[model samples]
Target: MPDILAVLNGVSPAWFLIVAGLLAWGAPWSPVRKALMLIGPCFALLAWFATHETGVYGVIDLGPFQLETFRFDSLSRIWVLVFILIAFINGVYALHERNRMTDGAALIYAGAAVGAVLSGDLLTLFFFWELTALASAPLIFAAGAPMAHRAGLRYLAIQVLSGVLLLAGAAVWASQTGSWGCDAIGVDSAAGVMLLLAFGVKAGFPLLHMWLPDAYPKATGVGSVVLSAFTTKLAVYALARGFAGEGALIAIGLVMAVFPIVFALVSNDLRQTLAYALINQLGFMVVGVGLGNELALNGAAANAFVGVIYMALMFMTLGAVLHRTGTVKATELGGLFKSMPVTGVCAIIGALSVAGVPLFSGFVAKTLILSGAHYAHNDLAYAILVYASAGVMELSVLKVVYCAFFGEARHHQVREAPQTMLLGMALAAFLCVYLGVDYRALYELLPFGIDDYEPYKLNNVFGQVQLLLGGAFVFALAVGFKLFPLKSDHTILDADWFYRRLGDGAARWGKAMGELLVHAINTALTAGVARLRARLFNLFNPAGALSREFPSGLMALWTAIMLAAVLLVSYFSPMS
Candidate 1:
């Protein structure tokens, strides 16, 4: 019964979280278990604030290598802090549930992410990077459905591949430079390319994003909520850390922004729609990282901070609906406001926040990115981003609200979410509005800053409001005319079609080709053996020259003559 915390080092708080996760299995008493679950992040935050300066906190030497476990800097400070906050919020939201596997995995996954952002070196980062994958896939499988199992396998494969690439990149980088520090790397190098892809896969970069939408919806309700919070944001932090200032990310970011809107618009499942919505938000951050100025980087950081909170709120609301109604299908959901009135209102706030309405967190955060794009005179990005903003409002906010909560009462018998869920959603919703109005709180915490950039600019607010209103008007028109994509159980194809559909076809074709090649080789060998047998028969059989009896008799006479000729030739040749 001695103090358990005495054993913890002051290196990084992630270790405490990891240990707490391990101990969750033995936590039998309900109150003690809940206390243990909440204490990890509380201690982590205490540890975070205890460090007064930005420097490497823990260093270890192993053979010829140095592992820097904790590095607090301007870049990592905000990310680590936000991760800790999200962990605490997720813990609170999950307190009512008693699934050990999901709870343990969530803690470990969060710890791994915490470790990753705080890692001072690529080696340390890679260790936690892989751990994030190992720890989180269980959350998906915890859903206990066949589809969840399959999606989990796919998720594991892709995530492990990312880890492999990370390890390779780290090794190559370390070999070439004699350093394993995590810093900005240009994609021109082999190490950089591998690392970019590794981060890209996690960040939901266009074609690499299907695993997220595919797997997240299949996870258990709470599992989906927790999964949505951590993994992708960790990747975004990596990009901000390592690939900032890489121009290619600008184009990559736009694609990330605009493409997912299409899928989200067409998606039938509320969770799936949110999955795509998450990608769309990541797109903005990716662009900010690509822009790489103080304003842009700040925008990216701020966007990430706000995005995590608002997105989690959205997921929480939807999770509540799923928990109560047993479905999140837009086709099946309607007039949920009748029963789950508080949940619906909270969800609407989350939607408005995500849509970047004035007086919401997303408005303040997303405006920074748009301002960066405009200031840089990257008109292409600027335009795409503006369009995407409107589109985001259309799909994520308007569409989600209409299909899930509004319209006639299809589901009339469900109750509002439990008090714990409502409490979690309320806390997050409060922040969404709080951060928006008093933007300085978040703006001051940005990794970097701009003196002149303002989220509350008259022109910025006016522009965003007009764009959203116009889009809403158009959406209303579209709905009136049945122009919007109708909801159905069917899903539209994306890059995953290559692997999901064409990949299977290619596999079948390759198998057939392999069979044909083996058969052809066997046929040729058999034919050659037969041909050889025929040739041998022709040469040595009774009809052949060596087996002819007349040849022997004639040969004897010829041999005598030949022997005489040989003897004469030998004598004449001077060797008798």
Candidate 2:
């Protein structure tokens, strides 16, 4: 094992993914399949740790291209570690899956995300940026439905466009700075805007976030877990690296934190609502990153790390419900605790954690971000973030657990989730508790030292608890008064509409123009053919060629006379 570890230390992240892809392609039912699935991510984690002491990855220069990058910094380590853990957990969740395509796509997606974070150059980052698109597209298609297919296409288009923007930004930045390495390039130029837009699209920043909710709910159970971890976090990391303190991101972050709460409030599909909620959670981290202070950046990093765990925990609980009930529509689900007590309990823990209840993972992580907001002295932003936090509790953690599980078992015969699923949820639930109670390890892993960071301050803890309870009270009041807005039947418009409708519109317009051009060409061709035919007929059937004229000899003599007259006329005309 030591020798193997030594040998593995020399391999690149890309090579590890390639090997995983090959295994996924070749061995569909190998008994060692489960072990093989985790190898790539484990390798990535090892690679990340190998660079921890050095604080950066060794630079590899390809002639004029220099890659000044680090594999395991404080920021990158947390994310990469979460990515690995997500892969491992998702693999466990998906162990019973029979779809090789789904498994393959999941592995590639995980590996690509890990590679993206570990990239040392802008060119390398762009490579993995596009790889994420290629890997995740199949997960959407793996749903095996028409809606999934359409959603997959739209998702692919959005991701590809993001990749294009990233590449364009990399090109511009490389030209201007004469290097392709990943550094703290300021966001004061066109290149910076392009890069920001690219990350924004991936981060699901406000209107650009349509692809997330549109596609995530449609993915398979395991697919949703995988989707929850990588793409947006990568965008946050990029923003942390490239656009920190840009001021623009502060506004962008504000919009991100607030808008999704409204949509989540009105959404019917439980998973879709969670998707909206997910964006809101990301918004807090985005604001922290934009603040660009040590505490703020550390909060953003910590939020992202804990957010992945809690997000996965939430999704797993919901997914288990969907798996057992065959539906996740909150309107249709109620009273499931009798059959699924274990899952129900696990879900409640997840919900409380997300709600930032006093002693859960969310409490430890989210408070860091809220404190950072307070430190930044953006009272308006802080207030909105506070409101959004309560909104998350109201819509997701509280509503999902109370309405879906504990209310009333709408269907009495519903079986508890499979033991495997419960086991997975339990593991995640344990992490949520362990991390919350003992967060010293997590805090130390943050890039900046927070010697004075205290999450247990009375004002902070009581304030967050008050918000949660107040939100819960409001929910109760709304339910009691029948004032809660019922879930809408129609799909609310999202950023994906541009690609779905706008792309469709552009395609329709192009087809119309093509038909017009084809008709014009056909008409011109027909006219040309008609003129040629007429000319040929006139040449073949000249006048006075039928029997109405005279015999052949008479006709010949007349032709000779007409030729002589023509010659005489020409001679006279010239001579005169």
lDDT of each: 0.84, 0.78
The superposed Cα distance between candidate 2 and the true structure at residue 442, in angstroms, equals: 0.9
Candidate 2 per-residue C-alpha lDDT over 99-175 given as tens digits, one digit per residue, 9 for 90 to 100: 77877777888778877787767887888889888899888888878998988888898999999999999999989
Residue lDDT tens for model 1, 303-414: 8999989889989988888888888888888888878889889888888899999999999999889888987899999999988986554566677777778865684589
- Model 2 scores worst on lDDT over the 10 consecutive residues at 546-555
Best candidate per lDDT, number? Answer: 1
In every candidate, how many clashes are there? 0, 4
Rate residue 295 of model 1 by lDDT.
86
Tell me the alpha-carbon RMSD of every candidate: 11.6, 10.6
